[model samples]
Target: MSTKTVRVLALVAFLASALVPAAGWAQQTLRIGELAGLTGGIAPYGVQIHNARLIAIDEINAKGGISVGGQKYKLDLVALDAGAPGEAVKVFERLLTVEKVTLILDGIYSSVEYALGPVLKSKKALLIWSGGNDPATTVGVPNAFRNHFDGGAPFMKVNELFLKKMGVKRVATYGQTGHADFKRFVEEYLPKIQGIEVVATEWHPFGEKDFFPVLTKLKGLKPDALIVHGFFTDGITMLKQAREIGLYPGPLWLNQYGAAPLMMDEASRAIWEGTYEILKSSWGVTTEAPERSRKFFQAYVKKFGERGFGAWAESGYDSVYILARAIEKAGVVDDPAKIGAAMQALNVPDVPELLMPYKPGKLFDKDRQAYPKIIVSQWKNGTFVPVFSDFGQ
Candidate 1:
């Protein structure tokens, strides 16, 4: 071969080597926004949910990440602290503008979810939040989706079970103040439920540790059942104070989120004993939970060292999988409309990675709200045992 021919062959070899590296570097980074409460009142739940999300992303990436348009993209989380409703807007804006993340998993107060609706719609970003019971959270906001229980349907079932099974007719409620969902439950749904009389209703300010006065007044009414609504920390405080003041063990106590992981510590073990909680199905580790959920719970315990897992942890884990699947379904990562539609169209068997026990149908309704089955569990000794299940929407 001539020298000129040899030089041409060398040039072709150099071009092929350069193109191979460029093709290998073509992989993209898909940033999922995590707007959670790292500080303030939402921290306790937010930190746990955030950790659960980390586990999900790590698992997804380990499996070679998600595929969209034939390109593999690893998931990256851009987390920001937004505990309060006001701070949520600012941080959410940063997620969209600075972080440039279109898909977000927000696990915090419902008020924060409600407050971010306008921004979510305006920015055309997709959000899957774990908690938001108010209708406005998803009613007018098409971009926002809630993967966990919402509104009063589940609570209505809880009330019905309380009356029929527990034989409790008279009910008194003490709920967190400024909580829109709890307020609606007390004023709207509770009144409409048949065969139950709400003898007395009281409210407590947010983050209030002193529930002795409220419990004393509530106990005076002598209702057959006392239904309390609040976060896990507040539930622990109320349970401890109610036990100290001799109001709970006698009244057939049922509290929301009393079974959260944060309340499983030694400090709350005594009070949480025998207490009942109406919560999302398979919220924590349980033998009766689905096999996938049991594995998820065991993974959490293994990684987080047995702190236990509940609250929005399942929803947070499911949300990550949902986003990944939605991206795959849409076949593209840049278009929010297609991705959001794919997310809304998801159902059981479609996204088998989901841990939440949603019914057989589309994962979301017309309003993008999910209605997962609720479970009634009682804390026996130090663990939660399922008393009843399948009271869904």
Candidate 2:
């Protein structure tokens, strides 16, 4: 079976099996709507995220579901494909009105999340986003929570950690032209550091596969590093094209997923080696650097047979844990509004097996963002190995 089909079948099995435990309880299953892109250009990411999410749901079911107000309730994850922006809105509506989910995963895409703000407010359902790094989603919405960082903060942190300390003078970037966070990082944050100068910058429109022209432009400048701040798929194509044309950039900082060695062309894989990825967690990082991240990789490979990418999927796995924790803390599963409040108030001691590298002291900011250390990893020997640096909580 294809990886997507396997994941879907597993999801079906979990949804079917979850209800067995709730049979005796006062509460039915608590549904978390995963707003994903399962059939579009971004479908691969959804597959990785939802599959990771299934592992969490299965664990909960195995333990006889969750306890809220002294009653046990099962967890059910419903995957809603947000392909086209309009269709995504309709799917979000269906998840709220028809499926009546207690909460929805932030629609992975920001446009879907933007239109979803009113839906969340209208239905009073909770929304948790892990993959998107944009800050706008949680800025003013009480119902929204981020399992990841504000989009640009990690890049700024990267600048502070690597660029400033290394004393790199000139830098160039390949970023999404219209992306707010990328543009801001290149224009605003990169300039903030004392000695660095952003000499050459190139932009690519969304879904422009061939990056030869842009790479050609960047190669001439030969900056210290080619900081690529595009989406994941674009980064893959750009790196491959850059290498194929015999102008492979060095010390690339890819602001996207890097654990996609399974998907790359073999030659492209070699070219992508040593590229940097600002991520939250990694499998190799667990053993290599001995950081506090989920022991998720081994189990995930065992179950899914090695098609996963992006540590963001690990955040998706953590999302379920955080939401369930919030529900139990609220002592109620019926009201998402109460759960949202509980999520904000959650400062529980971190478990040993946490997927998100939540800070030693706290779990979330006032805006409901996790303060996980920005785990930066690189592609070494076809695996993303964490580059350890001391970061503050």
Candidate 3:
């Protein structure tokens, strides 16, 4: 036969061999269900997490998804909105029994997390929590993992750093009524600090328009510091009213939840200036973190307009990527046990995108329980800058 004809025949033979399907080519796709509040009170945080998860999933798929034991499987994301605890429990039940999701990612409020704990424990579904910070959720649940730092621990740390170090002895506390977690932290934990006297504690109904009464009452105590714990809008309103009543200019005004990027804008900047906040992580600190975090920040700005990338946004973004990495290491899609094991074994050599400068084994215990260190961040010149670091000078 001629050389050209022989070459053509060889090419045809190779093409025919390639046409045959490989063994186990029809693998089932893996599904990760997300129960988020897309329209409720914490919708902004929920939406940011959901969008960041989608970004990670798309990037994984673009890289041809993850390969497990010689089979490639794509991720299927099922998102459902649960406006309240009752609705969240219903949605979670449906996701487990009906949707049969291999894994679940959710950031429902603390109340919803507590309500769904028993249900999730019974179902044995692996849960990656984003929003709930109550320590009770992590106490005995073996299948659950929390991505955000516990709120109570950080509050204590902030009090130690600011009130203790700055010599602010007497403090007045104010918060919303429905915030059981915050109140529990303050009442139970803050009093444990030495020489810190709580002169008065007041709780207002959520969404109460006028805070003049509360401010007037708190001002009457003549405390050395005023600590405010509430949602962004409520905190802003209280701060403005406190300023109007001449209750904020002299005392050290501290806030826990209101120092987020969205709350510290042009208008609120003057109001929240010099306010101390406890945060788990932040971007633009290249000294302690790996180069990947910087890359993630640049990519995020390039994709989404530079608007609301705060500490929580970084946590949400990193949570998805960390889960994906765990799945890749676990090498199984359907087995929750294996996935959980893989997550527990993950150790990023350095801080990656959405990750802080946390030690591997210390950050998460053997049971996948996380105990992240909290940093005291301050609003300096309209930016959230990390000022206190356990590892830094």
Q: Model 3: number of clashes?
A: 0
Report the C-alpha lDDT of model 3 over 1-393, residue by residue, as the tens digit: 999999999999999979976668655467889987677666756666676677677777777776787777777789999779888999998898888885888856677888888887777678888766665776577788877666655546655666777788988888777676778866887787778888888888767789999898888888888777766667778888988998877677777662465424678766777776653444443233447666666666677655655555556666776677677788877778788888877665422444554545544565455555566667666666666644211
Residue pairs with clashing backbones, model 3: none
- How much is 372 displaced in model 2, in angstroms? 1.3
Q: Put down candidate 1 lDDT per residue, 1-393, tens digits, no spaces.
A: 999999999999999887785664577789889888678766666777788899999899999899888788999999898868887899998998888888888878778987898778888788888754554588888888888776556656665665568888889998877778778778888877778899988888777889998799888899998888877677888888888888978887877653553436776766788878775555554436667777777788788865746656787888888888989999988888889999888876788888877877888889987777777777776666778766444
After superposition, which runs of candidate 3 have C-alpha atoms over 4 Å from their true positions? 1-11, 19-29, 263-265, 284-291, 348-354, 390-393
Query: What is the RMSD of candidate 3?
Result: 3.5
Candidate ranking under TM-score, highest first, comes to: 1, 3, 2
- What lDDT does model 2 reach? 0.69
Off by over 4 Å in 1: 1-25, 261-263
lDDT of each: 0.78, 0.69, 0.70
Instruction: Name the lDDT value of residue 381 in candidate 1.
Output: 69
Better of 1 and 3 by TM-score: 1
